[model samples]
Target: MKHLPLFALLGGMISGMAQAEIYKYVDSEGRVTYSNMPIRGAKKLDLGPAQVISSPRRGEGGGNPSSASRSPTPSDFPKVDTSTQKQRDQGRRKILEDEMRSEQQLLDTARKALSEGEQVRTGEERNNYQKYLDRVANLRNEVTLHEKNIQALNKEISNLK
Candidate 1:
């Protein structure tokens, strides 16, 4: 019957829509991969030989392909709120100054502890004295780090002006 050929053609069209052509590739390490998706980490890129599903070449489209695909160009540099930055710097400086004071207090405590520790004639007391010395060293390092941060912020503000 003439309807038989028409039904077979319709079935073929349905099957074409159901099946997807997977891309296959092999990396430099000789690892073969086949996927219906494209994602990062898989180096071998095969969007299939063109002409069937050709890529839009440059000049073929009115706009640059990158302009079309990419997000709007971000500011060349971050827009710094100078006033806000100065405020933040002031807060940081205050915190650092407080930390320096706290470190000085810790140093004083360690010195007193060591002086008291010297009077005690026991290995445990000497060990305790050494531990206090270590704490003082670490606190000094923290004070130094905070000072550096404050100095850096000052330099940045000066440069902004």
Candidate 2:
């Protein structure tokens, strides 16, 4: 019975992958739209054949089969010189640092706002504690989000060569 559901899910996924004709049309308002279903005045798109990548056979590798099947970079692929790559890495680091500083400022602002919000009680919020709590919760979430952004920025900056 458990396997039946799994089979059904797999069947649905396979059916969903069936190719469908795509059409593009410009509406009277000059807006362009694309859909699988043909519409009046819509023209069928001549999309090239879909690219297919074969799944790695089971037991191909003891660990990750995909890693074993991974292809090396093509000979014609573009390459960046060491100096250019270093310059790009420096630029990325500078951008990440600037972002971290802005996030820190936002975190400080959010923290200050949350502290102020928690202290003040006025009007309906004084009697309705839930409303006050909701406001404080939103402020706290903002502070948390900013803190997380700063952490991510710091991690990215540290990863730079």
Candidate 3:
């Protein structure tokens, strides 16, 4: 039983060391991709042995080099008071509300136009139903776009802290 455990441990270590080399490739669209499988014109990366570094936990005596050299927030940094921030938030809310109202109006107008188009058949529409369908599709798409815009604006307004 002791020899079996040792043999299994050695097998696991050997399998872990047999990792395939990673290759990087850039496609014609300028997008980079990395994979273990070989690709045409792929460049192999030599990522030497794994590195292990230990750092003391926060509040420990082992001083942090970054904290030692860090400086306080500069006085020149722009900061808005709470009242000023509130005013800015209110102004943003008002603009978004106005845009939402405009989008709602546009959606209503599009729905009305679509309804009118469906009710009345023009001389050209009588000759070809496809034209009428295309117009109706366009109007419907306009209404959907306005609705989506309104929803997005509402979501943004709600997300404001």
Candidate 4:
């Protein structure tokens, strides 16, 4: 009958669904094959779902109960270090002073050169020399700006104390 083929087809499907797939592979050394067994010497691995499956959690489904009622708040916070802050402030101030002094010395040398060049006789010579003077003036302004920055940083460090 035609029902015989249908029954056989259903039986085959049921049998296939009932049993999970069995993965087999050989190891690096000469050995026989294995099925559903984890071996230490084998390089390959099987990751079948039922072989290493995890069930759903209790609170996952619709009617599941929750063990934890609510999320937790902060228990405590760490304290800030005030004395180390003062040491950092002092170190920053010293670094600023060193940099400002270096910049000032460089600007002073540039201004001295500009002044000596200006002492030359006037004409096209003085015009070219005035360019050098302008350059030195710009450098002196930059040095002053750096000095101001150093003062501002010093004030910030003092405020932190």
Writing each residue's lDDT as its tens digit, candidate 4 over 1-161 gives: 97999999999998775454444566657566855544555444434565665545556552433334333345676555888877877887777677767766766666665566546544654568766666657666665765676577566646543
Error of 2 at 128 (Å): 3.4
Worst 10 residues of 2 by lDDT: 60-69
How many clashing residue pairs are found in candidate 3?
0
Model 1 misplaced regions, further than 4 Å? 1-74, 123-161
Lowest lDDT block of 10, candidate 3: 61-70
TM-score of each: 0.33, 0.63, 0.53, 0.33
**lDDT agreement with native, every candidate:** 0.62, 0.86, 0.85, 0.62
Write candidate 2's Cα lDDT for 97-138 as tens digits: 888888899999999999999999769898999999999999
- Pick the TM-score winner: 2
Model 1 TM-score, 2 decimals: 0.33
Residue 45 error, candidate 3, Å: 21
Per-residue lDDT over 31-95 for candidate 1, one digit per residue giving the tens place of the 0 to 100 score: 88876555355544445644665555667553665556545568796777989988877877776
* Pairwise TM-score winner, candidates 1 and 2: 2
Best-performing candidate as measured by lDDT: 2
lDDT of 4: 0.62
State the lDDT at 114 in candidate 2. 93
Residue 146 of model 1 has an lDDT of: 53
Q: Could you give candidate 3's per-residue lDDT for residues 1-161 as a string of tens digits?
A: 86999999999997676564788999999999998777999998788877987766667634766564345568999989999999999999999999989988998998898888788888899999999898889888988998899899999999776
